[model samples]
Target chain A: MRKITAALLITGLVSAGFAAKEEKKENLFEKKLMQDIKVLNEKIENLYKLHVKECAPEYIAKAEAYLDAIDGMSYINPDTGQIERTEISPMDKIIFENKARKYLAIAKEKVYSDADGDGIPCYQEIEQGTNPFEAEKKVSRAETEMKEQKVSEKPEVKKVGYQPLKMHARIHFDFDKYNIKKDYLPYLNVITRYLKAHDNLKIKIVGYTDSIGSKEYNDRLARKRAEAIKKYLIDHGISPDRIEIIGKGKEDYLFDNNTPLNRFTNRRAEFFVMEPTESQ
Target chain B: MRLLTAVIFSIFLTAGSYAETTTTELLDEAQNSIKAAFESGCPTYAPYEYYKAETYYRIAREETSKLNTKAGDAAAIKAIEWALKAMAKRYGEE
Candidate 1:
C-alpha cells in the first residue's frame, strides 16, 4: 500500500511540471499573438536569413522591441473583472505592426542599397556595366603589374673573378725608411676625412717592399711603414681597433724592382676599406 | 677651421643619405596606417586608395633597401596619406 501511494504521488508531481511548461509555451505562441504579429515575424525571420543585423542593427533592435511591446497590451474582462491576454485591442496590434514594418523597410533598404555610393545603385551598375566594381579592377590590374615586376627583378648573379679596390690613395715610402713623408700628409688627410664622415667603417693598410733585401728584414720594414699610417689615423681620432695592417714583404710587386722608379713603386702602402660583408 | 668644417658638412650631405632616425619614425607611422586600413576592410570599399597606399609603401621599401632614407621617408609619408584616405572612404568620411 505504501509503494502504490508513493508511485501515485510521483506521477502527480511529474504531470504538474509538464502542465507548467505547456502553459508557458501556449502563452507565447497563442493564436491571437500569432495572428497579430504574423507578417512582421516572418519578415524578421527573413532578416535573420539574410544576416541583416550588421547592416541596420538599430532598426532591427527597435522592431524587436515593438514585438515585445505587444505582450503588454491587455484589458479587464467586464464579467470577471480580471486582466486577460485575449482582450488586446486591434488598435494596439496595428500600431505595433506599422512601426515594425517601417523599421524593416529601412533595414531592407540599407541592405540592398548602392555599395559605392556613386549615386548609382549596385543593381543598376550591374545592369548597365560589365563590371560592377571598376575601381577594384584597377587594383587587380595593379596587382598583376606588381607580380610582373617581381618576376622581372629576378636575375642571375654575375660573380667577378677579382674584387676592385674600394680605396683612393696609395702612398710611396722612401727607400729603406719606414717613416711617413710629410708630402703624403694631404692624401692621408683625405682618407681620415672620409673615415670621420662614415664612422661605420674600418681601414686596412697593406705595406709592400722591393726584392733588394732579405724576406725577414723587408717584412719588418714593411710592417713599420704600415704602422706609421695606422698611428696617423689614430692621432686623427679614429679608434685603433678599426684599423688593420698587413706586410706583404717583397710580394705582389707593382713593377720590376731593378729600376729605382720600380723599387719606389714597390715600396708602397696601399689602403683598402673593409666592406661590411667581409668585416664580419 | 670653419671653412674646413663647412666643406666636410657639404661632403657629408653629398654622401647620399638622410637622417635615419627621422625616416624610421615616418615609416612606423605609415605601417600603423596600413594596418588600420586593412583591419577596417578599406581594401574592398576603397580599392583605389588602398592600391595607391600599397604602391607608395613598396616605393618606401625599395628606397630603404638602397639606403635612401630621405626618399624612403617621403614615400612612407605618401603611403600614410593614402592609407588614411582609404580608411576615410570606408568610414564615409570622404
Candidate 2:
C-alpha cells in the first residue's frame, strides 16, 4: 500500500509540471497576439487619419474595412495551439497598404489633372471659371494685353494731341568757356528733329558750371551757355517762344566734384521737354 | 546580469525612438521645402516638376505617419530633390 501511494504522488507532480509549462506557453502566445493587435490598431488609425487629411472618403472607408476584418479574425497557431498573431500576415498587410497607396495616386492624378500642361490644376481652373482644356493666361498678362488692345483700337487724332513726347539733350562745354562745341551738334540735331516732329512740345535749356569759379562768375558763364544753346535752336528754325533758358551755377552736380573727371561731368547743359497742361 | 540586460533593452528602445524622431524631422524638412517652392511660383513656372515634388512630399508624410521610417526617409529625400528641381526650373536654370 505504501508503494502504491508513492507512485500516485509521483504521477500527480509530473502532471502539474506539464500543466504549468502549457500555461506559460499559452501566456507567451497571448502576449505576442496582443502586441501585434496593438501595432495593427495603431497602423489602421494612422491610415484613417491620413485619408481624412487627404480628403479621401473612399480610402477612409477602406481603412475602416481593414480594421473590421482584423478585429473579426482569429490568430490561432495550429501547431502550438496558441494565439500568436492576427489573421493578416505582415506580407498581406503590406499588400493591402500598397493598394491604398495606389488608389490615392490614381485619385490625385484625376483630381489634379492639367490637361493643357498648365501649371494650374484643372480643378483650380474650373473653380476660377476658366476653360480647363486650354492654358489660361495669368491675370497680369491678360490685363496688359487688354490694355494694349484698347490703346491700339483708339482713333488717331489730327490736331489736338493728348500725350506729349518728353526728351532730353545734353551738350558738354569746354572747361570754362560757354561756347557750344561742334562735336555736340549731332546731339542737337536729333533734338531738333524731335522738336520739328512734335510742334506742340516746348524745350527748356538749362546750364550748369563746375565748382572751381566763384558763384557769380559761374552764374554768368552758365547764362552765356544757355544763351548760346538758344541762339543755335533759333538758327535751326525753332520758335524763340517755344524755348525757355535757365542757369544753374554749380547747384546740382552730377557727381562729387573732388576729381577733375567729376568736375567735367558737373559742367553740362541739360534740355528739359515740357508737356502741355490740360488747361493749355 | 539583470542590470546588463536592462541597460541593453533601454538602449534599444532609445534607438527605436530616435529612428521615429528622425523620420519626423525628415518629413518636416520636406514639407518646408515644398512650401517654399510653391510660394516661389514654382507651380506656375514648373508644373510637372512641382507636381512630382508634391507627390513625393505626400508620400513621405503618409509613410512617416505610418511609422515606416525606411520608406519615409527615401520619399522625403526624393521630395526635397524634386522640390529643388522645381525651383531651378522656375528660375530658368537647367
Evaluated with lDDT, which candidate comes out highest? 1
lDDT of 1 at A212: 78
Residues A52-162, model 1: lDDT tens digits: 543444466556645644544233333355654322344544565577778778867755666554555433433322122233345436745764564345322213112
Give the alpha carbon lDDT tens digit for every residue of B1-94 in model 1.
9999999999888774653446667778888898899898776566557655765676566557767554566567767877998888677442
Please tell me how candidate 1 rates in CAPRI terms: incorrect
**Per-prediction DockQ, in order?**
0.01, 0.03
Clashes of 1: 0
In candidate 1, position A215 carries an lDDT of: 95
For all predictions, the C-alpha RMSD in Å is 33.8, 25.3
Tell me the deviation in Å of residue A78 in model 1. Answer: 99
Docking class of 2: incorrect
In model 2, pairs of residues that clash are none
* Model 2 backbone overlap count: 0
Chain A of model 1 scored by TM-score: 0.41
lDDT at residue A188 of model 2 (Cα atoms): 82
